[model samples]
Target: MRLNTQIQGQGFPIICLHGHPGSSQCMSVFTHHLSQQYLTLAPDLRGYGKSYTRQRFEMKEHLQDLETFFKEFNIDECLILGWSLGGILALELALKFPEKVKGLILIASAARPRGNHPPISIFDYVYTGLAGLINWIFPSWRWNIETLGKRSLFRYLIQQHTKITYHYLAQDAVPAFLQTSGFATDALNQALRLGYNRLENLSQIHCPCLVLAGECDRHITAISSQETSDNLPNSQFYYYSNTAHLFPWEIPQTVLNDIDYWLTQHPEIFQSN
Candidate 1:
């Protein structure tokens, strides 16, 4: 699939997946801490970042690709950390291949396809659509990180580490975000048509689960996280104070600590199946 990936640290394999328009680099905050205890593999999902895409995007195909990636590393069982849209993929993976999943960690994930969400508002929809068109005309408009609601610290780090210019907004960032959002929407709609839903499949997941949500996130409310926890037979939930949808980026240490503690309490789960 020619996915752009970065592998660091050395221990049990931990696959980190980013959300829409977000590359693996989005999770770089946790690389140092996670690498300290486990091998970390973060990949830019196809159609985002440097990954190659053929035609249409398909969740099942992407899942299959990930399964192959795991097999290549001899990772029979490992932790899966997915954020936002990546969280959806994480749950799908666990559902489709429970034996390969050791533990599941979801950050700011939706329990099901949402309706009447803030981002779906008419203003945001029109604004984002216009912003996308503007980006198309002015590819260098992405440098304005302020519009992205990024904290100063995050903005500084991204500017210092990557060449993410304003143009990236129009050329890659914004479009990717919109595209993936649409992809998720379509997938969710199809699931509904097929009489399947996230809540409906939650009982099928037997793996230990850790669900984290941002206290201030309007996109995926804390209610979703709580419901996910309630649905999973073996799950624990935490809500980060003063955080938004970007909880992992905002508090990687806290998240890592929780994961470490959880794994410590469930060492038996990590053993080969």
Candidate 2:
């Protein structure tokens, strides 16, 4: 299955993978920023965004698609940057095809993602529903429930996931979250149930890796992200305070700088390619 992919820039390939309930569009910021210095490829995994498929698929299928994506693009070696669920896929890719992956840049993602992520509560459902209604009714208005209700829903969902109040959500986040296909969302959760852990096997992936985490992340804890780095044979970890899972969106420049610095440190990744 050939996924719908976004390609940019003109140097060593750097594949950017999005999180669960996300599409290639979600990784546009990274693609645009890195495109100037690297070849950035962002693909909408099967069942998400423009690649939506009715046939059931899990992480295993997604991995197969990515492998095919590489062959389709004549990509023999590339750096990978993954966010949330995409990070898990990157680890799997590096493990399964170590020769193809030169390095990794993981953001707000975990190798051993929790199998039992909290479900959206009734309150979340109510608020999200209200927010939708409000947005529909006042499509032109920006200050009403469109802002308040959507932000409230974001906070509630994050609280359910992390038991902490996430103070901010970028305006784009709401639309991105809403655009996710229900089928894709359910498939990811099912994939998680089937298992996505790589903790014990992490040592097998020896390539350079840079793991970035949000200290205030509501979904994945900084410690968990750090643990992923710790288990890897060659990896570095960094955490940003007062940031949440969407820090890449909240502070795009900072995240980009961090990635740039790490890439500079591992010049071999590009030089070898």
Candidate 3:
């Protein structure tokens, strides 16, 4: 399938992958800045945004789709930067195709199930439990048919998933949420069940890897990210204060600068080995 992608600038290629249940639009905050410095391409994963659709997808499928996506775009190798679920895929890619991946930049990513974001609101408490039950009792396809396809209803649900107050949401986040919502709920359900841990193989990853997170990130706590860094054979970890899960969006300039410095330190990574 021809995944719809947004490409800008013209330099070393850097592909940005968004989180589960999110489309490439969510990466716009970072892509907008990175595009000026690198040849950036952001695509809506299958079943989300303008990409091909399916009833469900697991982590492996996402990785495979991305492999094909790179080939179609004539990208043999380049930097792989992923946020949240996207970061998991980036790790898998590096493991599976070490020769094709030059380096990795993982943001708000972990190797195991994420702990609950703290200060859980009363709404999140109830909603989280409800979502868990829904995943267990129902198939992802059924939920996508019944609820995921409805844009308006999905938007409301998006607001509830965040730990942040809505005081700034409608103005700060909802627009992208609305545009990025047409994804299969099954993909997200599979992710929650993914428990996508590659602890044993973390040391197997030899490519230069950088993992970043927000100290205040509720989605995937900084503690887990630190562990991921600790296991990596060649890696570095950094966290920002008062930040949350959405690092690329929450602190675009910092992410941009950090990535730039890391890449600069290893100019050889620019070559696909």
**Leading candidate by TM-score:** 2
lDDT of each: 0.68, 0.77, 0.69
- The lDDT of model 3 is 0.69
Off by over 4 Å in 3: 52-54, 118-176, 179-183
Question: Per-residue alpha-carbon lDDT of model 3 for 1-273, expressed as tens digits?
Answer: 567888988888888887765777767767877788789999887776777564555546677788889789888778888888788888888888887778899988987746664354566545544443443344233453244322222222222333222212333344334444344556667667755678888888898989998776667888889899999988999988766675555456677899888988988887645
Clashing pairs for model 1 are: 139-167, 140-166, 140-167, 141-166, 142-166, 143-166
Candidate 2 regions with alpha-carbon error over 4 angstroms: 115-120, 129-151, 156-179
Pairs of residues at least 3 apart in sequence or in different chains that clash in candidate 2: none
RMSD for all candidates, in order, please: 6.2, 4.3, 8.7
lDDT of 3 at 122: 68
| Model 1 C-alpha lDDT per residue in residues 110-208, reported as the tens digit of each score | 657442233244655554556456546755444433453232223321222122334334444554554444444455456446642488788988888
What does candidate 2's lDDT look like per residue over 196-221, in tens digits? Answer: 67799998998999999887676777
Worst 10-residue lDDT window for candidate 3 reads 159-168
Looking at candidate 1, what is the lDDT of residue 209?
A: 91
Residue 252 in model 1: lDDT: 59
TM-score of 1: 0.73
At residue 105, what lDDT does model 3 achieve?
A: 91
